[model samples]
Target: MATKKTQILILPYPIQGHINPMLQFAKRLASKSRHLILTLLLPTSHARSISSHIGSINVQPISDGADQQGQQFQTAETYLQQFQRAVPGSLDDLIRLERGHDQPQPTILIYDSFFPWALDVAHSNGLAAAPFFTQTCSVSSVYFLFKEGRLSDEMELPHGIPRLEQRDLPSFIQDKENSAHLLELLVDQFSNLDEADYVFFNTFDKLENQMVEWMARQWQVLTVGPTIPSMYLDKCVKDDRSYGLNLFKPNRESCRDWLCERRASSVIYVSFGSMAILKQEQIEEIAKCLENLQTRFIWVVRETEMAKLPSEFVEWNLSSGLGLVVTWCNQLDILAHETVGCFVTHCGWNSVLEALCLGVPMVGVPNWSDQPTNAKFVEDVWKVGVRAKEDEDGIVKSMVLEKCVRAVLEGEKGEVVRRNAGKIKRWALEAVQLGGSSDNNIAKFVTGLALKD
Candidate 1:
């Protein structure tokens, strides 16, 4: 008799940052073993956006209640509530449907850590569960401590981790009064983690060795990432150039053309990611900073944020032939481009990993959530970039931004920064290559799953 094949269901929270990393991980799993079948489970609303482009991977679109009712009018909080309420039932139906078809029954469910409720669904359905954490191990460690109420005044910092002042913690923890909802969501990630069969972090052993080791002592933890596409790292997987999902259309041709005209390491790339909303004053400050630098640049100002730009900033900057403003562009392409020198970013984990992988120095203008902690590391721990200091009013002044950018682009410090960036890039490359730490972990995971089957 033939052996029963193993089917693994991978689910991400319905957002660009969450979906991209998990999707990349699914690709890695698929590439690692033919014995395992991979299925990406996305909310019906988000799946519609990238269903066509996610080639080769099976996507199972499960309803999120709000989608069936018309998501156009739902608030973020309401949408999440509905998703939590609706996904369990949708997941039950999906599992049953898959079994009824020619496909093998899903034996394992890999879910985003943000939704601990998925663990319950997995156990009740007789499937093993693993939680994939999208944040850095450092940030995740903080959340873990907070969840266990160990972040008190007397709590000692982990040995390998940096000392985190209150200001360096995720915004939700630092300002619980204003971010109670998000704090609740973050802390809830650890509620049922003890019951999970395994836990995965989107980081590599070399990058966070001490913390990864510490976390493993508590759970069946695995470090299986820097989960970007293969083409950018080791090129192990054929034609794997992108995460294969773009919620917003990218200005691919225009971005390429503009960057092509610039000299190597002469352009500044600016993007705040898909979700961060900069205040009008902050936007204007960044505009002034770019003008003061007087260098070739590409800025991604999403359409919703266009109104926040200072009047005539784009038109005048474009007329001067110093800047090109687009709604969105392929960030990896830009970061990997020879013309790009420094990345001004919101310090999102996805962007941070991409920059580290590409060896691009950064100027972090972190806005909220885990960004503050990420920025802290980018400047202090990694030594690959500088984080702009915000004034008392919490806006990075144009002068401060200019200094940070200049620090990364010129002078003796720039040389040191570039060296660190290059070193980190090599580590990232090795982490995903054949026989590397992440690759080994991925292979081990597949082996375990196949053995269980």
Candidate 2:
């Protein structure tokens, strides 16, 4: 008798952070057994760019309603309006086609919490649904708390996940500028979570133990992450080193050899992820500080943002040999390099997890979203990094940048930060190793998928 294969459908919000972790988890599940078939549902704008990278998964494009180029949409409101209207119908039709064909019926849909509409699609068709939250457990805990009607004018968390002021609320709920729909949507995502049979978080028990404990008191929350490449964690599968998901082409060829020239723990690696676009003055400030610090550094700046820099900045840095600047590089590969002494980041949770696993300390310059909360944890709770302070204009000037950089890379405080970062790194590795919490949870989830009728 032939055994039935578990068909898994993944639907990630079309963003780099959301896509990377989800794809990596897909690869992880595929590696578990040949009996699992992987499929990804992406918007038309992202489907082609990401399809070729995922080797084993079947890529299906769901209509997003605007031109394929995505030029017509500019703001989040406009894009969400289009996506919400387009996704359910396009996705329903695709499911019907799959059911009518030779393919196995999909058993479950794993989707990012931001796009709860996917849940309705799954339920309408009698498919099991799982909510895969891409946010750090700490940030999501804050959101969940707010959803419970526990948050009002009280900016400080009573349980103390991390010290957060009114300004540090989740980006959508923070200010007068936040859209009403966005705020309500975030709350509704948590409310809709009751429909999910299984919930997954892209975090590990050791990294955010308090937050994990808090959530477990209410519902079963599985911590199966720091969802990095399998190569870094279990080394369970061949050719699993890359997430195979990059919105921008990485320039690793230019960096591999250059990093070898620098001494150990001497270089500052700076990247603000794919979405942050710094003001021209902010770019100039960072460049001038990098030059004056006289430290070897590697900075990732897209070509589109070059105009924001001082004229000849690229040519001058190339000739000066003081640093290396490129459009992009394989971030994990670069961060894992021994020469990367410190990371200057926007404190995005994915970057934070990567750096923590690599034992790299940080100088956090938060821009928005959950970044401020992540930055606070980096500085206050973990003691693994220092948060760069911004002025009234919200600019982290050159001197402030230099001060924070030196504190993490050169000052007495840096010693403790490095030691603490190393400790966190060990804990992160332990969580994903054999018999670890994440390893056990992943195995349990896989088994549950096969058994669920």
Candidate 3:
């Protein structure tokens, strides 16, 4: 007789970074157990991108009171407010309907940590709540600390957590202008995490061992990541590289072909992830740094945010072989490419883990949020990257950008950075291999998760 399918319901916070890992885990879980049925609750607009990546899995798009065409709000704050208000009803309807179905009722709801509201929804519906964190376990711990009012400038944070000044948190929480409206959301992310029956982190033991240990002290946390594509982790799965989820339609060939022509480890890969909007002066400064370096570079700039660039510099780069600026590209493919040397990134946790696993040295130009803390770890703790210094105005000047880039590529420190990145990659590969800590943790979670009889 066949076993009943474990209907696992997953709800990711509506963003590419959050969705990608949760979806990857869903795929991983499905691949590991044939006796499982997976359903994802995604924003209606994002459903296509997700379906394209993992079409075999079940996906039910939730209407966030937005257009059905996938268009999202211009700002995160407004989007979160609207999304939080719109999602509870859809969740209630789906869980209620699924529980009454002929198949086994949904066993559990794995919701992103950012949407702590998911726990309340899970509680109301009698579903087990599992909070899945897409950020670094270290960052997740820090957020929980922030929520408890346990963090202060004078207090020394625990080991493995970045010793950040109170002002160094995400811009929405620390910056006077942005934080005023969105600060509460930052706290809310961790508020409900503890109430979860199972807590998940897209990280592994040894990667952030101290943080993982500390996090488990309060709640039994499971480390089940670098929750990335199986291909990158050297799993023996075909077509596993295409996570098939991108908010932007990436032109991979153009970027891949461009990367091929560049000398090995000579290209500077620069991206600020999906959300950061750089000031015009910052953009111009970066332009000058690229021009001054005279090396091959690829920069991902959003189309709407392109106006921040100096028109003269933009036109000049169009003609110069020094840089290639596209709105978006397959970031993982680019990182894996041999020609790419150093990454200049915004230090989003996914990007941080990706760079580490790939063994690419970094020039961290952190903007806001956990980025500063991640940057500190990259430079001070991991010894795999250098953090670029910004001026008093909070913009990394052209000179600082130039120096950090050069340091990672040619300076005396480059050798050590490369060596450390190489060392970490080896450990990361080991962690994801068969019976590795990450692999075991995920397998353990799968075997133990069950539904009410």
Candidate 4:
């Protein structure tokens, strides 16, 4: 019999945040001294961007023949069905193709937690399939909590519970109807987790021990994050680096140059993430709030127009030259810049990690989904940021936003938060160093799977 070759293939869910950590994992595995070939499967939209970042690896785009028009699919079911149709036999086809090549066929398949179909594909082919949970371990634990019926009633309570209660629960679980559907899906999916050869979390063990212990009891779970080391290694091997999904034009250099001109620890960087849609009134509120602070600010607003703000407010900011607004900014580069003292963010996991890694304090205004939970982690557990309060109308009021921003930027509390953020940044860097928690976990994960084969 011919010797089976060792290869690893990564399939990430078709979203920006989901794709990033998986790409980091692939990059790490590719750097290993072992002779394992690595392949990354991404949406066509992500392939070009991911391709530009790494070399000597194959980026396979799954082409779902849906109309390329701007029509969006709202639910996961519809999106998965569309992709299934477009990439009908692609997974199996890829396996067969690898086997026919002079090189080895893939021995392990690592896929996003949301892509359950990859689990079935791996099982049928007798290959190890590891599920990568892209969110923090706390978020994943809360998910399993809801699955186990521990979080249902507490989630329904109106108010006055501890911040941990609200934050630990997944954001979708807050809505009764959506939570019902989400719980059902989670239960069904989690039941199959035991069959998975290994489960990978993009977090460090020191962050969420309770959840990590729970997950490990059921399946072999590894805590290998914040995934920055892998990304840094990938960058070291390349001379040219690219940013953003290849779709939008990037303004990274401009944002960095603007930061260069500002005083140290003076600029507040604001971004609502890639998918948040703020109403006109909300935009006006935030714009006015920034004006009230009179601080140097760089805000990334993705909308085509900004008619919501008062004309006077815009004029004052423009005249003072204290604020620069762009439709989109290069977030990573901006966060890493030394002059950026604070981040007013939507609390996406990737943004949270980036800010923590760079030791920048945050003012979290969570919009939707996992953001609320992520925001809670930043403020409650990490002590590196504060949460902005929403008004009676459920929108974050301008005054409250301003207060939070100023508190994080200039107040005495701001200094303490910044110091703590610096501590966390050191921890993040150490986690990815040689023989660190993240490094050991990845090595053990790969070796365990290899032995299984």
Candidate 5:
């Protein structure tokens, strides 16, 4: 007779950027082992979006105090407080209920690093805990150093990591005074990490070998990512084209038609991920930059953000036949398109990985969080893209944005960026394929669990 399967539970912070990567990981874990049962536990608000698209992995809704309120919390701090207060009780109840069921009880708790409290819940219930980090290892290293009080005033970083000035640090640390709550949240990720069985980051080994090596010295670090759907990478997982969850329903058909009409490597694609709310002035500057380029472009201006765009910009673009200003679209689809040349992005980790995995060069206009650090690596370390410089007032002017885009899309610098992008893209693909670095790491995790069982 076959032995019982190991039951695993995953909990991600309830946001698009966080949920998608962790969900993809759940999918991959399920594919790797028949002896593992994976369940994704999301807050009620986020779990409502779960549907047929996510196969095999069970999705369960837990309370975050939003079910009764029937709306989002007004502030990040408030949301965190409520989620922390509510989720632990719900998780304990769920684990108890599962223990009474006929199936295997959850043996592992894979949680977002943001909620160190979950590790406590796991230990209380006799489960091994793993923390999933959705950011690059470089950014994580800075936070770890800061948390340990080892980061120096002069920014003397670890050996394998590049030296960074204050500005190159994650924005939360750079403006710690104004962003106290957020800075605390990020640094707190390391507080209970030592107790975790495994620490996972959504980055490949080749992309940050030194940083990953530095991080591994302290924890069971594993790099099992790109974490994008397999169809975009190795195609080993059948028909896995989408991330299976989106906060916004994309205008897929229109976006695909528009890109198909453009010439090869001739269109500019622009998007800032879900949460970034650019100031009206910054939006106008970006509008001006796109207008100045006079090339085919597709811009994703979320419905809420559309009001900040220059009045009649959409109408003007439509009439000029030079751009498509969409509310939201399948970003991976856009990046994978041959007509797309460069990505103008907010440099969110997920967006950066998608662009890198798809071999698209970028002009990074990072706004906040880990974006600035990711942008720095894009230009200085990866050499696969250029970061658009901002003016004294901390805004990227139209001319500066135009010049950055031009450098990535034309001339010798463009060639170098594209070539580097192509080279890294190949590495990204290899990392996810069978016997590749990331794949091996994933296999190790599965095998380790089996050996323990």
Candidate 6:
């Protein structure tokens, strides 16, 4: 009789944040299990980047023929259609690539929550498929709620719910027309989750005990979080890997030098995640507000120019020596820096976790999707941040932005927020230590997935 082999194929949604977590999970699996062979199904563009950062794992770039169009690739719908057409054939190709090897074929498909087609592909191929929820368990519950028709409208959530809002819904689920189709797709996809061996969430059980319990009653749910720490531990014990997975080219020197000059806990760092684009007017407003506050800041401004800024406004801080603006920066490193006091953020999950881990307070400026809910958690529940108000036009005004910045930086409440953030940071660090909830959950997840064997 032949020895049984376990092959796990990981297919992540082709975006930076999603891809990063999936890669970390793959790395963790690789470290613990020799019986498991890992194959990452990635975009052609991302293949080289991911491969460079990860260890001895096979990266198979899916060829959709759409990538040949290059710059012409416009909408999400187009990418989805192309991916749907390509993934099945790509999976077959990967299987063929594995067949001549001295190992078993892929027995499990580990996929992102957004990729519903993975379930279909895995079922057709007689393989178990596990969905990886990259966001918080709270956010995932909201998604499941929407699918169950618990929420009537998309724009604004029904008011009396103590813990959540309609804005907590995922980006694609924010529109009624779009959400109808999305909920239908999610319902179909999630209904078959029981067929999968297990589902993995990038959050610890202690962090969300209620949601984890609810999910466990439905399907096998494994909570594994702060994957970065796990990756760091792996590096420390194993190969001394300097970095995990980062797709974007970060601006490092400028921000670090700026941080070096500032006093400890004095500079504010501001960044919206990659996808949130600001209007030229909005950008100008933010610039003006930052200038008005007269505090030292490190701002990540992706776009080159803003139309509404006066000529003087553009030149206001060019040589002012108090602000450092860059297109992108090494955010994790900056957050961990001593001089960094607060974050003015778009409230993406990864950013929130990073801030919490570093004990840095924030000025929450939730742009869209689940960000408002994230803001609510930070401001209301965590007591680590303050929310900026939206004007009558529902736009966040310059004055409001300035006020929130000042509140986070200098107000009496800011001191309280700072202390709360520090406490959360201590708890976050403790959670990752031996005997801590996050540490214990990782072990449990590994054992449940049979990766420990």
Model 6 per-residue lDDT tens digits across residues 254-284: 7887788889988879898877877666777
Q: What lDDT does candidate 6 reach at residue 239?
A: 49
Which residue pairs does candidate 2 place in steric collision?
none
Tens digits of lDDT, candidate 3, 197-262: 888888878888887888888886888887778788766444678675778888789999888888
Q: Which candidate would rank higher by lDDT, 3 or 5? A: 5
User: What tens-digit string does per-residue lDDT give for candidate 4 at 209-246?
Assistant: 66677667778898888765344322432322332233
Q: Please list the C-alpha lDDT of all candidates, in the order they appear.
A: 0.89, 0.83, 0.82, 0.74, 0.90, 0.71
Best-to-worst lDDT order: 5, 1, 2, 3, 4, 6
Q: Can you give the lDDT of residue 263 in candidate 3?
A: 87
lDDT of 1 by residue, 135-202 (tens): 98889989888877788766687856678877788999989998888899999998988999999999
Tens-place lDDT per residue, model 5, 1-453, is 897798899999988999999989988888898888888898887777676337777888888878878877788678888888889999988888887898887888999999888899999988889999999888898888888888876766875567777767789988989899889898889888989999999999999998889889989999989999999999987667788888898999999998988899999999999989999989999999888899999999999998898876767787898999899999999999999999999999999999999999999999999999999999999998999888888899999999999999999999999999999999999999999999999999999888887
Ranking by TM-score: 5, 1, 2, 3, 4, 6
Preferred candidate (TM-score higher): 2 or 5: 5
Candidate 1 stretches greater than 4 Å from native: 1-3, 71-74
What would the C-alpha RMSD of candidate 6 be, to one decimal place? 3.7
Instruction: Specify the poorest-scoring 10-residue window by lDDT in model 3.
Output: 48-57
> What's model 3's overall lDDT?
0.82
- Write one digit per residue (lDDT tens) for candidate 2, span 353-376: 999988999998888778888898
